[model samples]
Target: MDLQYVNFFAVAVLAAVIGVTLIVVHLSQRKLRAELTQLREELALWQKAGLHAPRAVAAAEPDARPSQAQGAPMAPAPQPLSEEQIRERLQQAAGAGEAPERYRHVVTLADKGLAPEEIARVLQVSSAEAQQLVRLAEVGRKKS
Candidate 1:
């Protein structure tokens, strides 16, 4: 092929590659936006319920301190829920089932002020999942 034809073919291929890359990026952005919106909605629900990690649990772990400087005034800790309250919350969150018993156990561990890591160890779940369950219990109690 002539040198001119070869150069033209290379440019055309480059353009096609760029077009496909743009399309992929556009689709990825749309998926990420949708996920972000869903997460925002969930966060709003939690906030409306006035949920946060229990204060007593935070105090028990030395590393769970607020990010604020030592001199800064910390936000007042939320009142800890009684074990009975925790069980009630777990029942509500878990719903009616033998499986809910597992969820109920989460609050039992949490009621003792166990950290998520300890809870994970007891429940054989990932620490992150244990944390989520703890938050779920918190949300359950705060709801209504």
Candidate 2:
């Protein structure tokens, strides 16, 4: 009778250990699944917010032409000037002492084929003026 009781107690202890281990495994699996679901939700929300959206460029479409329906006419092309004309203008400005030293440097650089923006940086002039100087220099070169 004592041997039978010992056998039953041993089996009961083994069953209890197996049940606890299964419960722990199930709980861990559930936690992992919940974390995976949360991550998926966050990724979906980010995509919906357009974080990975495609960009549209008007120039990219060759067939989609600019609308001329608006009454704005295209500006006339600038006329090229003679080198003598450009030199005379510079000389006149220099004679008056009103021309900034930077403007002279920009004209010199533009004559040497430096882009307007680069000339502007070197001469510390506004980019618009640098562009104008570059155009004038181009015209002067062509006329010469």
Candidate 3:
């Protein structure tokens, strides 16, 4: 085969891969748009329910401490918190990993006779998770 033909074939393959990637990206974007819409709706509901996180401390808020006189004595430093205290204070910090509340809630809802779909919708979790929760709750019930 000619080197020129081989080069052209490689270039053609590269173009095809790029085209397919772009198509996949377009499809993914569409799915993301749908998810965005759902998220917006959930956010609105959260706002209406007054479930928003605390507002960030902004520059507009005045400092709580008044300016000290030029020779004011320094305040005593606060004692350091213990490891358990620090862990308690840092509950749910970033990188803490998955919370089990959803699983517990799923089991609770299942025990309350809610279907897997209803539990998933109420908890905003996957149907599979809700089903597993129901199974877990059933096992517990049998064990007890």
The C-alpha lDDT values of all candidates are 0.66, 0.61, 0.58
TM-score, prediction 2: 0.31
lDDT tens digits, residue span 1-144, model 1: 899999999999999999999999999999999999976875564455455333343345654444456564554444555667666656754575443544566777788788888776555455666776787667666763
Model 3 per-residue lDDT tens digits across residues 1-144: 999999999999999999999999999999999999977875675565455521223422333323346554545434544545534433442136633444445555576677876665555445565665566555545544
Cα displacement (angstroms), candidate 2, residue 118, comes to 34
Weakest ten-residue segment in model 3 by summed lDDT: 53-62
lDDT of 2 by residue, 1-144 (tens): 699999999999999999999999999999999999976875564465444321233223433333336554544434555667767776676578665444545555566667776665544445676776776555545644
User: How many steric overlaps are in each model, in order?
Assistant: 0, 0, 0
On TM-score, the candidate that comes out on top is 1
Give Cα distance to truth, residue 142, candidate 2, Å: 62
What residue pairs clash in candidate 1, if any at all?
none
Instruction: Give the best candidate by lDDT.
Output: 1
User: lDDT value for candidate 1?
Assistant: 0.66
* Model 2 lowest lDDT segment of ten: 53-62
Off by over 4 Å in 2: 49-144
